[model samples]
Target: MWRSGSDAGAIAIGVVVEVPTPGTAVKHPEALGADLWRTDEPDLDEPRTGIRLQEIRLTSQEGFLPRVVVKADLALSSASIITMPNGTVFPLDATQANAMERLWGLTTSQSLPALPGASEGQRKLMSHYRRERSNTLRLKKLAEVRARHGKCVCALCGIDDSSKYPRQLSERIFEVHHLLPLATAATPVRTTLDDLVVLCASCHRAVHATSAVEDNYAVLAGHLRGES
Candidate 1:
Protein backbone atom coordinates (compact mmCIF):
# COMPACT_ATOMS: atom_id res chain seq x y z
CA MET A 1 0.00 0.00 0.00
CA TRP A 2 1.25 3.49 -0.75
CA ARG A 3 1.72 5.45 2.44
CA SER A 4 3.68 8.50 1.39
CA GLY A 5 5.91 9.91 -1.38
CA SER A 6 7.84 8.09 -4.09
CA ASP A 7 11.60 7.81 -4.71
CA ALA A 8 11.45 8.63 -8.41
CA GLY A 9 12.88 12.13 -8.05
CA ALA A 10 15.35 11.94 -5.20
CA ILE A 11 18.52 13.96 -5.87
CA ALA A 12 21.91 13.35 -4.33
CA ILE A 13 23.10 16.64 -2.88
CA GLY A 14 26.32 15.93 -0.99
CA VAL A 15 28.91 13.22 -1.50
CA VAL A 16 31.92 12.22 0.61
CA VAL A 17 35.33 13.18 -0.71
CA GLU A 18 38.70 12.35 0.80
CA VAL A 19 40.84 15.33 1.77
CA PRO A 20 44.14 15.68 3.58
CA THR A 21 43.62 15.52 7.31
CA PRO A 22 43.18 19.05 8.69
CA GLY A 23 46.10 20.55 10.66
CA THR A 24 48.58 18.07 9.17
CA ALA A 25 51.70 19.69 7.79
CA VAL A 26 51.23 20.27 4.10
CA LYS A 27 53.31 17.94 1.99
CA HIS A 28 53.93 18.51 -1.71
CA PRO A 29 51.56 16.28 -3.73
CA GLU A 30 54.60 14.67 -5.36
CA ALA A 31 56.43 14.32 -2.03
CA LEU A 32 53.42 12.37 -0.69
CA GLY A 33 54.29 9.91 -3.48
CA ALA A 34 52.04 7.88 -5.81
CA ASP A 35 49.88 6.23 -3.13
CA LEU A 36 47.19 8.85 -2.57
CA TRP A 37 44.92 6.31 -0.85
CA ARG A 38 47.21 6.21 2.19
CA THR A 39 46.50 9.88 2.86
CA ASP A 40 42.77 9.28 3.30
CA GLU A 41 43.08 8.39 6.97
CA PRO A 42 43.02 10.92 9.74
CA ASP A 43 46.53 11.67 11.00
CA LEU A 44 47.69 14.32 13.47
CA ASP A 45 46.01 17.11 11.54
CA GLU A 46 42.62 16.80 9.71
CA PRO A 47 40.32 14.30 11.44
CA ARG A 48 37.18 14.86 9.38
CA THR A 49 36.12 13.66 5.96
CA GLY A 50 34.90 16.22 3.41
CA ILE A 51 31.22 16.29 2.50
CA ARG A 52 30.69 18.70 -0.37
CA LEU A 53 27.47 19.82 -1.97
CA GLN A 54 27.25 18.97 -5.63
CA GLU A 55 23.85 20.04 -6.98
CA ILE A 56 23.76 23.82 -6.57
CA ARG A 57 20.84 24.83 -8.73
CA LEU A 58 17.48 23.61 -10.05
CA THR A 59 15.67 24.99 -13.11
CA SER A 60 12.25 23.95 -14.31
CA GLN A 61 11.94 22.93 -17.94
CA GLU A 62 8.89 22.89 -20.12
CA GLY A 63 7.56 19.36 -20.76
CA PHE A 64 10.29 17.99 -18.49
CA LEU A 65 11.07 17.88 -14.81
CA PRO A 66 13.43 20.39 -13.21
CA ARG A 67 17.09 20.02 -14.07
CA VAL A 68 19.57 19.65 -11.22
CA VAL A 69 23.00 21.13 -11.83
CA VAL A 70 26.22 20.75 -9.87
CA LYS A 71 28.26 23.70 -8.74
CA ALA A 72 30.88 24.87 -11.23
CA ASP A 73 33.50 25.67 -8.61
CA LEU A 74 34.43 24.31 -5.24
CA ALA A 75 35.25 26.35 -2.15
CA LEU A 76 36.68 23.32 -0.36
CA SER A 77 39.86 21.41 -1.13
CA SER A 78 41.24 21.73 -4.62
CA ALA A 79 41.26 17.95 -4.89
CA SER A 80 39.00 16.74 -7.71
CA ILE A 81 38.06 13.46 -6.05
CA ILE A 82 34.43 12.79 -5.12
CA THR A 83 32.67 9.70 -3.75
CA MET A 84 29.19 8.94 -4.99
CA PRO A 85 26.38 7.31 -3.03
CA ASN A 86 27.08 3.98 -4.73
CA GLY A 87 30.62 4.07 -3.26
CA THR A 88 32.22 4.88 -6.59
CA VAL A 89 35.14 7.27 -6.19
CA PHE A 90 36.68 9.07 -9.12
CA PRO A 91 38.50 12.30 -9.88
CA LEU A 92 36.28 15.05 -11.21
CA ASP A 93 36.42 15.39 -14.97
CA ALA A 94 37.40 18.62 -16.75
CA THR A 95 33.80 19.80 -17.13
CA GLN A 96 33.04 19.18 -13.47
CA ALA A 97 36.27 20.92 -12.45
CA ASN A 98 35.41 24.00 -14.50
CA ALA A 99 31.88 24.00 -13.11
CA MET A 100 33.22 23.98 -9.58
CA GLU A 101 35.44 26.93 -10.35
CA ARG A 102 32.52 28.90 -11.78
CA LEU A 103 30.39 28.12 -8.74
CA TRP A 104 33.16 29.22 -6.41
CA GLY A 105 33.38 32.54 -8.24
CA LEU A 106 29.68 33.20 -7.74
CA THR A 107 29.62 32.42 -4.02
CA THR A 108 31.07 34.34 -1.08
CA SER A 109 34.56 33.27 -0.09
CA GLN A 110 34.32 30.92 2.86
CA SER A 111 36.43 28.26 4.46
CA LEU A 112 35.38 24.66 3.76
CA PRO A 113 35.76 22.77 7.03
CA ALA A 114 36.10 19.05 7.39
CA LEU A 115 32.83 17.42 8.32
CA PRO A 116 32.49 15.53 11.59
CA GLY A 117 32.03 11.75 11.61
CA ALA A 118 28.75 10.82 9.94
CA SER A 119 25.73 10.23 12.11
CA GLU A 120 22.56 8.64 10.75
CA GLY A 121 20.88 12.03 10.61
CA GLN A 122 23.86 13.78 9.01
CA ARG A 123 24.14 11.10 6.34
CA LYS A 124 20.47 11.55 5.44
CA LEU A 125 21.05 15.24 4.76
CA MET A 126 23.07 14.27 1.71
CA SER A 127 19.87 13.41 -0.18
CA HIS A 128 17.05 15.65 -1.38
CA TYR A 129 13.71 14.13 -2.41
CA ARG A 130 11.66 15.78 -5.13
CA ARG A 131 9.60 13.86 -7.73
CA GLU A 132 7.81 10.58 -7.28
CA ARG A 133 5.22 8.23 -8.74
CA SER A 134 1.59 9.18 -8.54
CA ASN A 135 -0.80 7.19 -6.30
CA THR A 136 -2.55 5.84 -9.40
CA LEU A 137 0.65 4.46 -10.85
CA ARG A 138 1.78 3.00 -7.55
CA LEU A 139 -1.49 1.20 -6.95
CA LYS A 140 -1.55 -0.14 -10.49
CA LYS A 141 1.96 -1.44 -10.19
CA LEU A 142 1.25 -3.11 -6.87
CA ALA A 143 -1.76 -4.85 -8.34
CA GLU A 144 0.21 -6.04 -11.34
CA VAL A 145 2.99 -7.41 -9.13
CA ARG A 146 0.59 -9.21 -6.82
CA ALA A 147 -1.18 -10.71 -9.81
CA ARG A 148 2.05 -12.13 -11.18
CA HIS A 149 3.46 -13.31 -7.86
CA GLY A 150 0.16 -14.72 -6.56
CA LYS A 151 0.64 -12.87 -3.27
CA CYS A 152 2.38 -9.94 -1.63
CA VAL A 153 5.65 -11.00 0.00
CA CYS A 154 8.96 -9.45 0.79
CA ALA A 155 11.04 -9.60 -2.39
CA LEU A 156 14.27 -9.67 -0.37
CA CYS A 157 13.37 -12.17 2.38
CA GLY A 158 10.16 -13.82 1.11
CA ILE A 159 8.23 -12.98 4.26
CA ASP A 160 4.55 -12.17 3.90
CA ASP A 161 3.45 -9.47 6.31
CA SER A 162 -0.21 -10.41 5.92
CA SER A 163 0.49 -13.75 7.51
CA LYS A 164 2.87 -12.56 10.21
CA TYR A 165 1.07 -9.57 11.61
CA PRO A 166 -2.46 -8.76 12.72
CA ARG A 167 -4.94 -8.48 9.87
CA GLN A 168 -5.54 -4.78 10.47
CA LEU A 169 -1.84 -3.90 10.52
CA SER A 170 -0.28 -6.50 8.21
CA GLU A 171 -1.02 -4.92 4.83
CA ARG A 172 0.19 -1.54 5.98
CA ILE A 173 3.55 -3.03 6.96
CA PHE A 174 4.63 -3.87 3.44
CA GLU A 175 6.16 -1.32 1.05
CA VAL A 176 7.35 -1.14 -2.52
CA HIS A 177 11.01 -0.35 -3.06
CA HIS A 178 12.57 1.10 -6.19
CA LEU A 179 15.12 -1.29 -7.70
CA LEU A 180 17.47 1.34 -9.07
CA PRO A 181 19.15 3.97 -6.92
CA LEU A 182 16.84 6.97 -6.99
CA ALA A 183 19.72 9.44 -6.71
CA THR A 184 20.99 8.46 -10.14
CA ALA A 185 17.80 9.58 -11.86
CA ALA A 186 18.60 13.18 -12.80
CA THR A 187 15.31 13.53 -14.64
CA PRO A 188 11.88 12.09 -14.05
CA VAL A 189 10.96 8.90 -15.87
CA ARG A 190 8.00 6.60 -15.77
CA THR A 191 8.60 3.89 -13.17
CA THR A 192 7.52 0.64 -14.74
CA LEU A 193 5.98 -2.19 -12.79
CA ASP A 194 9.18 -4.22 -13.13
CA ASP A 195 11.21 -1.45 -11.49
CA LEU A 196 9.66 -2.03 -8.09
CA VAL A 197 9.58 -4.85 -5.53
CA VAL A 198 7.44 -5.68 -2.55
CA LEU A 199 9.15 -5.74 0.82
CA CYS A 200 8.27 -5.80 4.47
CA ALA A 201 9.10 -2.74 6.52
CA SER A 202 12.13 -4.32 8.21
CA CYS A 203 13.63 -5.79 5.04
CA HIS A 204 13.02 -2.56 3.15
CA ARG A 205 14.96 -0.67 5.80
CA ALA A 206 17.84 -3.17 5.60
CA VAL A 207 18.04 -2.94 1.80
CA HIS A 208 18.28 0.87 2.04
CA ALA A 209 20.37 1.30 5.21
CA THR A 210 23.02 -1.30 4.31
CA SER A 211 25.25 -1.20 1.26
CA ALA A 212 25.24 -4.95 0.70
CA VAL A 213 21.57 -5.15 -0.16
CA GLU A 214 21.31 -1.75 -1.82
CA ASP A 215 24.17 -2.49 -4.22
CA ASN A 216 22.84 -5.81 -5.52
CA TYR A 217 19.23 -6.57 -4.81
CA ALA A 218 19.27 -9.75 -6.90
CA VAL A 219 22.23 -11.20 -5.00
CA LEU A 220 20.60 -10.46 -1.69
CA ALA A 221 17.36 -12.01 -2.86
CA GLY A 222 19.19 -15.14 -3.99
CA HIS A 223 21.03 -15.41 -0.68
CA LEU A 224 17.82 -15.06 1.26
CA ARG A 225 16.25 -17.75 -0.91
CA GLY A 226 19.17 -20.11 -0.09
CA GLU A 227 20.21 -20.26 -3.73
CA SER A 228 23.51 -18.46 -3.17
Candidate 2:
Protein backbone atom coordinates (compact mmCIF):
# COMPACT_ATOMS: atom_id res chain seq x y z
CA MET A 1 0.00 0.00 0.00
CA TRP A 2 1.04 3.70 -0.41
CA ARG A 3 2.41 4.55 3.01
CA SER A 4 -0.01 6.75 4.91
CA GLY A 5 1.49 8.43 7.96
CA SER A 6 4.23 10.89 8.92
CA ASP A 7 5.77 9.85 5.59
CA ALA A 8 2.51 9.58 3.75
CA GLY A 9 3.95 11.14 0.61
CA ALA A 10 6.77 8.65 0.42
CA ILE A 11 6.83 6.12 -2.43
CA ALA A 12 6.94 2.75 -0.71
CA ILE A 13 8.31 -0.18 -2.69
CA GLY A 14 6.75 -3.62 -3.11
CA VAL A 15 7.20 -7.02 -4.76
CA VAL A 16 5.38 -7.49 -8.03
CA VAL A 17 3.33 -10.66 -8.27
CA GLU A 18 0.76 -11.45 -11.02
CA VAL A 19 -1.59 -9.04 -12.72
CA PRO A 20 -5.39 -9.26 -13.16
CA THR A 21 -7.24 -9.80 -16.41
CA PRO A 22 -10.73 -10.25 -17.89
CA GLY A 23 -10.99 -13.90 -17.02
CA THR A 24 -9.97 -13.51 -13.38
CA ALA A 25 -12.33 -11.01 -11.78
CA VAL A 26 -14.04 -11.95 -8.46
CA LYS A 27 -17.52 -10.86 -7.48
CA HIS A 28 -18.62 -9.21 -4.22
CA PRO A 29 -21.43 -10.80 -2.25
CA GLU A 30 -22.30 -7.48 -0.63
CA ALA A 31 -22.42 -5.74 -3.98
CA LEU A 32 -25.02 -8.26 -5.05
CA GLY A 33 -26.88 -7.81 -1.75
CA ALA A 34 -25.93 -11.15 -0.24
CA ASP A 35 -24.30 -12.02 3.09
CA LEU A 36 -20.87 -13.53 2.43
CA TRP A 37 -20.11 -15.87 5.37
CA ARG A 38 -23.64 -16.46 6.62
CA THR A 39 -22.79 -14.93 10.02
CA ASP A 40 -25.72 -16.48 11.82
CA GLU A 41 -24.77 -20.00 10.75
CA PRO A 42 -20.99 -19.83 10.57
CA ASP A 43 -19.97 -23.00 8.79
CA LEU A 44 -16.77 -24.21 10.42
CA ASP A 45 -16.59 -27.31 8.24
CA GLU A 46 -17.04 -25.43 4.95
CA PRO A 47 -14.66 -26.84 2.36
CA ARG A 48 -12.32 -24.58 0.41
CA THR A 49 -11.56 -26.68 -2.64
CA GLY A 50 -8.86 -26.09 -5.27
CA ILE A 51 -5.23 -25.01 -5.14
CA ARG A 52 -5.06 -21.25 -5.76
CA LEU A 53 -1.30 -21.23 -6.06
CA GLN A 54 -1.31 -23.47 -9.16
CA GLU A 55 -3.20 -20.89 -11.24
CA ILE A 56 -0.94 -17.87 -10.69
CA ARG A 57 -1.12 -16.49 -14.22
CA LEU A 58 -2.48 -13.30 -15.74
CA THR A 59 -4.66 -13.01 -18.86
CA SER A 60 -7.77 -11.08 -17.74
CA GLN A 61 -6.50 -7.89 -16.01
CA GLU A 62 -5.34 -5.80 -18.93
CA GLY A 63 -6.90 -2.48 -17.97
CA PHE A 64 -7.40 -3.22 -14.31
CA LEU A 65 -4.07 -1.72 -13.28
CA PRO A 66 -0.69 -0.90 -14.68
CA ARG A 67 1.27 -1.89 -11.58
CA VAL A 68 1.00 -2.78 -7.89
CA VAL A 69 3.11 -2.86 -4.68
CA VAL A 70 4.19 -5.37 -2.05
CA LYS A 71 6.21 -5.11 1.20
CA ALA A 72 9.45 -6.68 -0.13
CA ASP A 73 11.35 -9.97 -0.09
CA LEU A 74 14.87 -9.78 1.28
CA ALA A 75 15.26 -13.32 2.48
CA LEU A 76 14.81 -16.63 0.67
CA SER A 77 13.84 -15.01 -2.64
CA SER A 78 16.63 -12.45 -2.43
CA ALA A 79 18.10 -13.94 -5.64
CA SER A 80 15.05 -12.74 -7.61
CA ILE A 81 15.42 -9.10 -6.49
CA ILE A 82 16.26 -6.67 -9.24
CA THR A 83 16.64 -2.92 -9.81
CA MET A 84 13.50 -1.31 -11.20
CA PRO A 85 13.36 1.13 -14.10
CA ASN A 86 12.64 3.92 -11.63
CA GLY A 87 15.74 2.93 -9.69
CA THR A 88 13.67 1.51 -6.84
CA VAL A 89 13.12 -2.07 -5.77
CA PHE A 90 10.82 -3.26 -3.01
CA PRO A 91 12.22 -2.37 0.40
CA LEU A 92 14.49 -0.39 -1.95
CA ASP A 93 17.69 -1.69 -0.45
CA ALA A 94 20.32 -3.55 -2.45
CA THR A 95 23.39 -2.88 -0.33
CA GLN A 96 22.00 -4.50 2.82
CA ALA A 97 21.48 -8.06 4.03
CA ASN A 98 17.88 -7.29 5.01
CA ALA A 99 15.99 -4.25 3.89
CA MET A 100 13.64 -3.12 6.66
CA GLU A 101 11.24 -4.69 9.12
CA ARG A 102 7.81 -5.32 7.55
CA LEU A 103 5.13 -2.77 8.52
CA TRP A 104 2.03 -4.90 9.11
CA GLY A 105 0.48 -6.66 12.13
CA LEU A 106 0.63 -10.28 13.37
CA THR A 107 -1.67 -13.19 14.29
CA THR A 108 -2.10 -17.01 13.93
CA SER A 109 -5.62 -17.24 12.51
CA GLN A 110 -6.10 -18.81 9.03
CA SER A 111 -8.70 -18.67 6.27
CA LEU A 112 -9.51 -20.64 3.10
CA PRO A 113 -11.39 -20.09 -0.14
CA ALA A 114 -15.04 -20.77 0.60
CA LEU A 115 -16.78 -23.38 -1.53
CA PRO A 116 -20.53 -23.14 -0.99
CA GLY A 117 -21.66 -25.71 1.60
CA ALA A 118 -18.16 -27.22 1.69
CA SER A 119 -16.47 -27.52 5.11
CA GLU A 120 -12.95 -26.43 6.13
CA GLY A 121 -11.93 -29.95 7.15
CA GLN A 122 -13.11 -31.29 3.80
CA ARG A 123 -11.08 -28.67 1.97
CA LYS A 124 -7.95 -29.81 3.77
CA LEU A 125 -8.70 -33.41 2.86
CA MET A 126 -8.86 -32.40 -0.81
CA SER A 127 -5.70 -30.30 -0.81
CA HIS A 128 -2.44 -31.49 -2.41
CA TYR A 129 -0.27 -30.91 0.65
CA ARG A 130 -0.58 -32.32 4.17
CA ARG A 131 -2.89 -29.86 5.89
CA GLU A 132 -1.81 -31.01 9.33
CA ARG A 133 1.85 -30.27 8.63
CA SER A 134 1.29 -26.70 9.84
CA ASN A 135 -1.29 -25.95 7.16
CA THR A 136 -2.99 -23.07 9.03
CA LEU A 137 0.25 -21.45 10.08
CA ARG A 138 2.01 -22.08 6.76
CA LEU A 139 -0.82 -20.72 4.65
CA LYS A 140 -1.07 -17.62 6.84
CA LYS A 141 2.59 -16.98 7.74
CA LEU A 142 3.43 -14.41 5.07
CA ALA A 143 0.70 -12.11 6.28
CA GLU A 144 1.56 -12.97 9.86
CA VAL A 145 5.04 -11.57 9.30
CA ARG A 146 3.52 -8.47 7.81
CA ALA A 147 1.27 -8.01 10.80
CA ARG A 148 4.01 -8.69 13.28
CA HIS A 149 6.30 -6.02 11.85
CA GLY A 150 3.67 -3.41 11.26
CA LYS A 151 0.63 -2.77 13.45
CA CYS A 152 -1.94 -5.48 14.12
CA VAL A 153 -4.94 -4.55 12.07
CA CYS A 154 -7.81 -6.43 10.49
CA ALA A 155 -6.87 -6.21 6.82
CA LEU A 156 -10.41 -7.19 5.85
CA CYS A 157 -12.57 -5.15 8.21
CA GLY A 158 -10.18 -2.18 8.44
CA ILE A 159 -10.12 -2.67 12.22
CA ASP A 160 -7.13 -3.09 14.49
CA ASP A 161 -6.63 -6.50 16.18
CA SER A 162 -4.66 -5.23 19.16
CA SER A 163 -7.51 -6.05 21.51
CA LYS A 164 -7.00 -9.31 23.37
CA TYR A 165 -9.78 -11.88 23.12
CA PRO A 166 -11.30 -14.25 25.66
CA ARG A 167 -10.29 -17.25 23.57
CA GLN A 168 -13.39 -17.96 21.54
CA LEU A 169 -13.91 -18.57 17.83
CA SER A 170 -16.26 -15.56 17.79
CA GLU A 171 -14.02 -13.42 19.94
CA ARG A 172 -10.67 -12.65 18.24
CA ILE A 173 -8.05 -14.02 15.94
CA PHE A 174 -5.90 -11.78 13.77
CA GLU A 175 -5.84 -12.51 10.02
CA VAL A 176 -3.96 -11.49 6.89
CA HIS A 177 -6.14 -11.12 3.85
CA HIS A 178 -4.91 -11.14 0.23
CA LEU A 179 -5.96 -7.98 -1.60
CA LEU A 180 -5.79 -9.17 -5.20
CA PRO A 181 -7.24 -12.52 -4.22
CA LEU A 182 -4.15 -14.70 -4.61
CA ALA A 183 -6.34 -17.67 -5.54
CA THR A 184 -6.41 -16.44 -9.17
CA ALA A 185 -3.17 -14.36 -8.92
CA ALA A 186 -3.86 -12.30 -12.05
CA THR A 187 -4.68 -8.93 -10.58
CA PRO A 188 -1.44 -6.98 -11.20
CA VAL A 189 -0.80 -6.87 -7.46
CA ARG A 190 2.43 -7.38 -5.58
CA THR A 191 3.15 -10.48 -3.45
CA THR A 192 5.30 -8.98 -0.70
CA LEU A 193 3.99 -9.77 2.80
CA ASP A 194 2.73 -6.17 2.98
CA ASP A 195 0.17 -6.80 0.26
CA LEU A 196 -1.52 -9.45 2.37
CA VAL A 197 -2.82 -8.67 5.87
CA VAL A 198 -3.62 -9.16 9.55
CA LEU A 199 -7.35 -9.57 9.37
CA CYS A 200 -9.77 -11.61 11.47
CA ALA A 201 -10.92 -14.94 10.00
CA SER A 202 -14.48 -13.65 9.80
CA CYS A 203 -13.34 -10.66 7.73
CA HIS A 204 -11.02 -12.76 5.60
CA ARG A 205 -13.94 -14.99 4.59
CA ALA A 206 -15.85 -11.88 3.63
CA VAL A 207 -13.01 -11.35 1.18
CA HIS A 208 -13.18 -14.49 -1.03
CA ALA A 209 -16.67 -15.13 0.27
CA THR A 210 -18.05 -12.71 -2.29
CA SER A 211 -19.07 -14.75 -5.33
CA ALA A 212 -17.68 -17.06 -7.97
CA VAL A 213 -18.33 -14.52 -10.70
CA GLU A 214 -16.27 -11.32 -11.19
CA ASP A 215 -13.46 -10.35 -8.76
CA ASN A 216 -14.22 -7.66 -6.23
CA TYR A 217 -12.03 -4.65 -7.10
CA ALA A 218 -13.37 -2.42 -4.33
CA VAL A 219 -12.20 -4.80 -1.63
CA LEU A 220 -8.81 -4.95 -3.28
CA ALA A 221 -8.53 -1.17 -3.27
CA GLY A 222 -9.31 -0.80 0.44
CA HIS A 223 -7.64 -4.06 1.50
CA LEU A 224 -3.88 -3.67 1.97
CA ARG A 225 -3.62 0.01 2.84
CA GLY A 226 -2.60 -0.30 6.50
CA GLU A 227 0.60 -2.23 5.79
CA SER A 228 4.17 -1.06 5.28
Highest-scoring model, TM-score: 1
Looking at candidate 1, the ten consecutive residues that score lowest on lDDT are: 1-10
Q: Please report, in order, the local distance difference test score of every candidate based on alpha carbons.
A: 0.51, 0.36
lDDT computed for candidate 1? 0.51
Report the lDDT tens digits of candidate 2 across residue range 25-82.
3222112112222356334333222222311112222111112222244341342223
The deviation in Å at residue 99 for candidate 1 is 40
What lDDT score is found at residue 211 in candidate 1? 55
